[model samples]
Target: MRIPLIAGNWKMNGSLALIEDFGNAFSRTSFLSNAIDIAVIPPFLYLANADEAFEGTPVQIGAQTLYGEASGAFTGAVSASMLKEFGVHYVLVGHSERRTLFKEDDAAILAQARAAIDEGIVPILCVGETLEERDENRFDDVVLGQLDAVMKGLSEEQRRQLVVAYEPVWAIGTGRTATPEQAQEVHASLRARLRHYDENLADNMRLLYGGSMKPANAQELLSQADIDGGLIGGASLKPDDFIAICHAAG
Candidate 1:
């Protein structure tokens, strides 16, 4: 059975104080010691702070994003190696905001994924469709296309280390969530696509559902066969809600 992974993406939110407080509080919670994988993806500037706070706890630390190149004149861009120095265990790639707002194409995302994997960081590759795409009935195509570039070139070992989060664009941060059935359909499709590459990976790979996955709906959503976990947003900032979601996964 795949272990459930609930990763909190703090996004551009959080100061050093918030990171430290959250980590200290979360670390004290015994639920983390249960049969589940938990990670906190804080902003670039606070990775080390969060790491220190989460030290001696089961919560792993990660980064919101990273530059694809190892070293460059790209001012303000952070490399995977730098993140590794901060002990980042995972990296978010192709988040909808990065894709739509910053216009990061699939090629760049693929490069980022490769860089993170090379540095022994698990890349939480985000794939999703906008409301229009889903309405047009092209949701699957859009999502699977996002995966093709990054996934196609990965070695089997690299593939196994990845975590895929399906966050429908419309639902993200909009207080809307895909019904369990809707999320499961896409997760099943993603798993089926992976089977073409490696059966074991398809079976064992963890697929998380993103977009407004809160305490109230967590249990039902997680009950689906292919929905392995969640990539949380707003609710993650609150200790009770985030811990509740983790408990639901358990």
Candidate 2:
């Protein structure tokens, strides 16, 4: 069975002091079991500190984003190799914010995923549809298009290191959430599409349901067959809520 993973996308939030506090809070909490995997993707500036804070704990440290290239003259870009040097275990790619705010295309996201995997960091690739697409009944097309781009040029082995996150654009940080059934439907469809690419790969890949995943609704969402865990947003900032979601996964 694919192990359940609860990942917190800290986005652009948190400072060094706050990260230490968050790490302290996380370390004190008792996990449901070793069956669950927990990760936190803090801002790039805080990665080194977060990595040191989480040392020897079950919680894995990750970076919110990474440059597609290993290293270069890109003034502001953080390369995948650099993240790995800081002991980062996961990287978020194709996040809605990146796609919307920075106009990141699928090809760019694909390159970032490749770089992360090449550097031994797992990529938590985000794929989702907008409110307009959902209203027009074109959600599936949008999601599949995003997935196809990343899947392209990826070998079977490379694909296995990925964790796909379904975070409907309308739901992320909007205080809205896809119902349990709605999330399961899309997650199931995503898995079915993966099966067409490679059955064994599809079966092993972990599909997480993101978008306002909180303590109140985590249990219901986690109980769904296709919904593995969550890529939490606001709730993850709080230790209690994040831990609650992790326990729900168990």
Candidate 3:
């Protein structure tokens, strides 16, 4: 049985004051016992503070991004090892924004995934197709290509330690969400691809649906068989909504 994981990706958001308030509110909530695993990925600067803030709680802290190198003079990069030092257990890699804005290709994302695994940090690898590709009926090929690049140098064990987030590029932050069936179809396809790589790993791995996920539609999305959890965006910023999503997972 796969445990549900509801993760918040606070992309380029939150201040120390906001983090403090969020933390306080989170601590006061009555989360279901081990029903769902809740994680928050804040900006790199606030990780240590978030970790301290969520102390003694089941809420885990994650990083929005991390460099492939463990320690380097790369000037402005936070490595996986450095993130581990700050108690980060998960790292978001290959987000759609990073792909479109920073031009991060599969090779770079794969390297980051490998580095995160080496340092024992779970990498939430993002893969999806753009609206044009979907319209062209080449969505499968696009998503598969992205996953193939990352799976190239990884072993079955390493792959199992990683999580995959399928955020349809066109839907992310666009106020449009893939219908529950649409999201499940893509998720099932992803799981089938993983099964082709390793059956055991595929069965145990958690696949999250990102892109405009919120409390309102969370129950419908979470009810799908292959949809293990979510890689939440805008709705994650609020304490009540995020907590509601977690409860929906239950």
Candidate 4:
């Protein structure tokens, strides 16, 4: 069975002290079970701090974003290799914020995903539809389009190292969430799409739901057959809530 992964996306939040505190708090909690794996995706600036803080613990540190290029004259851009130095295990690629705010196109996202895979980092590729697209009945088309774009040049081995996160744009940080049934349908469809490339890989891939997934609703969502885990947002900042979601996953 695919190991349930509860990854906390710190986004643009957190300070060194906060991360250290969280690391200490998380270590003290009884949430580190063999049934699941946990990761903390902090901002790039604090990756080293988190890495040191969470050392010797089950919690792994990840990067919120990374540039596609390995080494270039591109100022203010971080490469996958740079993240690897900090012992980063996972990288968020094509996140909704990257796609919507920074205008990262499909090809750019694909390049970033490839860079992460090439550097031996697991990329949590985010794919989902917007409220407008869903209302217009183009949900599957939009989501599948994003997935296909990333799969274009990736080898089967690289594909196996990926973790797809289905985070509907409308529900993200908007206080709205996809019902268990709604989320399951999209997850099931995405898994089916993966089968076209490699049936074994598709069956083993871990698909996570991200969109205001909190302690209150985590159990029901985790109970879904297709929904393996979560790419948490706000709730993740709180140690209790994050651990609660992990418990739910277990």
Q: What 10-residue stretch in candidate 2 is worst by lDDT?
A: 170-179
Alpha carbon lDDT at 76, candidate 2:
89
Clashing pairs in 1: none
Q: Score residue 13 of candidate 1 by CA lDDT.
A: 88
- Residue 3 local lDDT, model 1: 94
For candidate 4, write residues 1-250 as lDDT tens digits: 9999999998888898888788888778665467898999988889999999988778988898889889989999999999999999999999988999999999888889899999999999999888788889897689999999888678888889899999988775466667889999899999999999989988999999997899999999988898999999998888788878888887
Which portions of model 3 show Cα errors greater than 4 Å? 173-176
lDDT of each: 0.89, 0.88, 0.89, 0.89
Clash counts for all predictions: 0, 0, 0, 0
Q: What is the per-residue lDDT of model 1 for residues 1-250, given as tens digits with 9 covering 90 to 100?
A: 8999999998888887787778777767886456899998888888888889888878899898898999979999999999999999999999999999999999999899999999999999999999888879997579998887778978888888899999889775566667899889999999999998989989999999997899999999999999999999998888788889998997
Clashing pairs in 3: none
Where model 1 places Cα greater than 4 Å from the true spot, the runs are 32-34, 173-176
Candidate 3 lDDT by residue in tens digits, 62-132: 99887877786899888998999999999999998899998888888988999999999999999998888
**Model 2 residue 145 distance off true place after TM-score fit, in angstroms:** 0.8
lDDT of 2: 0.88
Estimate candidate 3's alpha-carbon lDDT, on a 0 to 1 scale. Answer: 0.89
